[model samples]
Target chain A: MSEIFVKDRELVMPGDVLAKSIDILPGNGTYRDGEEIISKVIGLVKLKERFISVIPLSGKYIPKPGDRVIGVIEDVQPTFWNVNINSPYLGLLLLGEAVREYVDVTKTDISKYYDIGEIIYAKVLHVSRSGVVSLSMNDPKAKKLRGGKLVRITPYKVPRVIGREGSMIELIKEKTNCNIIVGQNGVIWIKGMNEGLATRAILLIEKESHITGLTQKVSKLLEEGDKK
Target chain B: MKKGKPERLIIDGKRLDGRDLEEFREMEAKIKVIKSADGSAMFRFGNTIAIAAVYGPRPMFPKHLQNPERAVINLRYNMVPFSTEDRVRPGVSRRSIEISKILKEAIAETVFTEEFPRTVIDIYIEMIQADGTTRCAALNAASLALADAGVPMKDLIAACSAGKVDGHIVLDVNGKEDNYGEVDMPVAMIPRENKVVLLQMDGLLTKEEFEKCLQLAKKGCMQVYKLQKECIKNTYKQIAEGDENV
Candidate 1:
């Protein structure tokens, strides 16, 4: 007999038993211990059919493959540039992956392509088991982000900021008339007429992420900003 | 000059602080006390206060120290000059170094270090006030801080001390009892797994008395564990309740 100890969306601490059954598999932020599925962090319990996962409320961002991230160039080597993606590990952007055009390293300086301290919107190509993150800028959308204020929130709250089907982000973009780029690593770039208004709305969403009626609340906040 | 031991520490079935044999000192635990730290907590056992701050799981420096298989834990335990009645010299003392190593190992046992391989998690524990069982307070604070930082772990570590005072097996030895007590044993364990990760004894006890002391200490640890869980839950509750100031 399988028994679920906690209800869906319940708050659980480390070592708190979530279920007692072999059939129910553990997911992210949770692990199996003997016949019990236990939480490995302080997070909200999420149950999906046969899998149970916990969404962490706080922590450093862990890079995953296929994630879009905004990173600052820390060092430019001969063939690669080290990008600080707001994670424990630095993202390596190889010269070949950074630009489509082939530039002879002997003839041209690599730093000329992406210099230090410049922020770029890129994609994580791979993450090794040892935590080495490889990044690429091959996509048309990937480019250097310029003259915009950067705002950071907890990485876990990024989803709430984006909202369902980009409703929240689209709302902010419409109200503030700004082009916003949100990175999975919690780095956000806002560029346009009302940068301050857009930044405030994004932060408000981060602060009240877990509360109910967030969409309505965010829309109200954006409307209030438009008046002033 | 050596101070003489007290004539008796237990009288009328009560210890010096007027508590029973298996009673712990009044404890208080709080998390997110330090704004700058990734995770921070303060734990208090009566007058003894310990504040711990966790910085990383960030990239490790000095390349050779980096472990490809798991993250390394670096813990520092320090006592402020005014923590005790007499001014403790600033900087790491031999006693603090030894305690730091043991507490680091104890905390490492619970953390899932393999999740963030090639990184180093730094834990700094400061003894703001000194009473007896300071190491236990430090361990408690460190564990809470790790959880507050959202470090994945098997379980939260809880620590407390038990000792023999005037031939009575008592829980949570205080500064006065530590000076005059016949035995002092500090124990730290994972409450859910019932696994002891850290244990040390400063004095000898009969085999039967040792068993009793261990049991008393385990009981005290469970109580502390309950308080830790409550402390963490309360912080989240305030945020979930839509507090504008949080």
Candidate 2:
């Protein structure tokens, strides 16, 4: 049997041992050294049946393949568009993968579709070993985001905002009656009725993500909003 | 920058600041002070105040500078013109540059840079006030900021300084003591691992005094580690309670 060293939701710091048994598997924000699983970040320890992981408290987003992200177009080239994905590295959106239709290179204005400063929803196609990001808009769900309240939360807390199998987000959407899109890079878009309430709830989640029983607190907030 | 020496630094086992010879100054640390930065912290050690902000683990600019296997760390240590009694120049100085390099090496000792290949982590430490031992305060604040930013690491770095003054060894030397002290030694370490990352000395010391000073500095750093951890936990504690202000 694997022995857990820390209780669930306990605060852990770097080099803190979370487990001392070989049967215990280490997850993200944790690394195994010898027979010990040690936390690599200042975060909250989460224990599963046979796995242990530490969820970071705060940090910027690092792009990974297949993540859906929202970015702003920074520059436009003939073959590709440079997008700022809220990271140190710039993301590239190739003209060929942006849309289904092909255009004559001699007489096409790509800016009309993705002008500078335009917000776009694109899926990460690849993140190179050198930190170069490649994005694609070919997914049917990906498109230009229209006017909406765009809020940025700590990317590390994205999973918390989403909750188990997206139940938390579903609850927020149902309670506020708003259309919401959460980008893996921490950018969120909210539109429709009760946008303010939805934004408030998201902000709350970002601030209190480390806390246990957060889903209930969010529900209480929404219920109070209903009464008001 | 010179001032007349005080009559005594330690009298009746108390130092100039009313602290015992081995006691530290009043210290306070706060995290998440800057919304714009990925991680930020303000640390105050008595009259010395320093704030550190962390940005990145992001893509490195200047394409050629990217490290394919690990993240590069850039550290900047600066003191405002008004930080001290004299109005120092606003730009980088030789002292600042040297301190910056040493600080970078100290912090790099703990971080697991391999996790983010070809990325860069930028650390900025600004001294808003300076009494003495600003570098130690800055390093402590920067370590907390890195943790606040959630940078993966082996352990948190803690630093403190000790000096010999008036024929006695003192912990956390103030400006007055630093000017006339026989020896000044600043030490940085990974408190959990009990590993030293930074060690610098200026002035003369006997072999026995050096060993004693090292132990004292280590003790001081451990104390700082306790407060730093508490500050980080308090932020989460308030949130865990579902407080609206957090």
Candidate 3:
């Protein structure tokens, strides 16, 4: 017995209230009070005779093309490098794509130029009609990332870190006195005054990443550090 | 170095947040925490929490695709649409696909797939909440899921990120730090082998910064791996000792 309407894209947790007396997709949800139904969870619809499927939202990551990424060199080959892009699929930094300074890439000595031990920052070129990933480091925004530490977070948090209009990051830099760069691929670089300060800032960033009022909390923490 | 709202602190050499270095968000985790699944685990880093499940040694269908000599590993990495602050569009996005592929590779490397020919292994990873370092936590969660399902893996893989910002480098940057930081490097490793299975980085860094970042990344990855290994061993021991699964 509940009474509330959950529109599409609205978040609904288990046991949350949903308005009653309204019809929903069959198999979408049950009407405990006045036809209340869960928006996404599977349940029986009150007035619908034909079965309508309601698929519960299952969390998963599905990679799309053109998404920028911070990839690690897993293995290097003569012409292409195998990169782990934090996705289920691997990316290829083909000889030509890594160093796009040339034309007719197939005729280049890609191996002598970039080999086994280097990590390049790039973006998805295509998932290919065959589902294989092709990456490019030639784009103006794409370049080789060097001399920095990396941490992995679930791809899910990339948004949170970026915050609304990049607010979260703006706050991190202002407080920790660090220069940070966030990649859509879920990699971050925090360059601060010193290792001690840098480490401290990173710790706080990881800690309050999920809190709504984190900027305030971070400011408070930074002030306390200043006092010391 | 970065700007924020007036109330937001932006001190010289101070962080956007007023906190000092060395502070970390509260962390909590549970393994085989649920009795219903073959294997399941829950882990939280700061505010991010992820749950993983493993199912397999099931049948091989379409007989043609079945391998009489090895197990077929099927992995699906998904993030719930509501796992973050803003709503996520329904269905698979590009990020999930990449994660799925990388994750499959990790499992394929470890699983004794050839031994379980004609069998299948399925791993499902879900994010309950997103804070930061979800991938590292997910890797640990994935390992637990496999172990919980009694899937044999060569090693437990642990992952983490390190980065350089402003002239110094640090480990385990959160969402905020991740966004604004200069250099970001993420890595997944087989701690036992001191070997890497996956690595990624972005942003700008000098050669010196890059080396430090790499060192720190390895250090953090190894430590996380240790914890995962212990967690797995403990869970397995509990099962052997006839302890409760939940």
TM-score, prediction 2 = 0.93
Each model's lDDT: 0.91, 0.88, 0.61
Per-residue lDDT tens digits of candidate 1, residues A1-228?
898999888889998999999999999999999999999998889999999999987788999999999999999999999999998899999999998898899888999889999999999999999988999999877999988888988899899899999988999998889999999999999999999989888988876676678888888988888898
User: Which predicted model would earn the best TM-score?
Assistant: 1
For model 2, the stretches where C-alpha displacement exceeds 4 angstroms are A1-3, A223-228, B242-246
Candidate 3 residues lying further than 4 Å off, grouped into runs, are: A1-228, B1-25, B233-245
True C-alpha contacts between chains kept, each model in order: 0.79, 0.84, 0.00
TM-score of chain B of each: 0.96, 0.96, 0.84
DockQ comparison, 1 vs 3, better candidate:
1
Candidate 3's residue-wise lDDT over B1-246, tens digit each? 234424422245455454333333455556666555656777666767889887665555666887766778887777788887677776688988887888788767655575455656777888888766777667768776665454545556667777765555767666667666666677778765577887777788888878887778888776665556556445434543435342
Sort all candidates by DockQ, best to worst. 1, 2, 3
The per-model DockQ list reads 0.78, 0.69, 0.01
For model 2, state the Cα shift of residue A36 in Å.
2.8
Per-residue lDDT tens digits for candidate 2, residues B176-195, read 78887677788999987789
Q: Write the number of the candidate with greater DockQ, choosing between 1 and 2.
A: 1
Ranking by TM-score: 1, 2, 3
Q: Estimate each model's TM-score.
A: 0.96, 0.93, 0.47
Relative to the real complex, the DockQ score for model 1 comes to 0.78
To one decimal place, how large is model 1's interface RMSD in Å?
A: 1.2
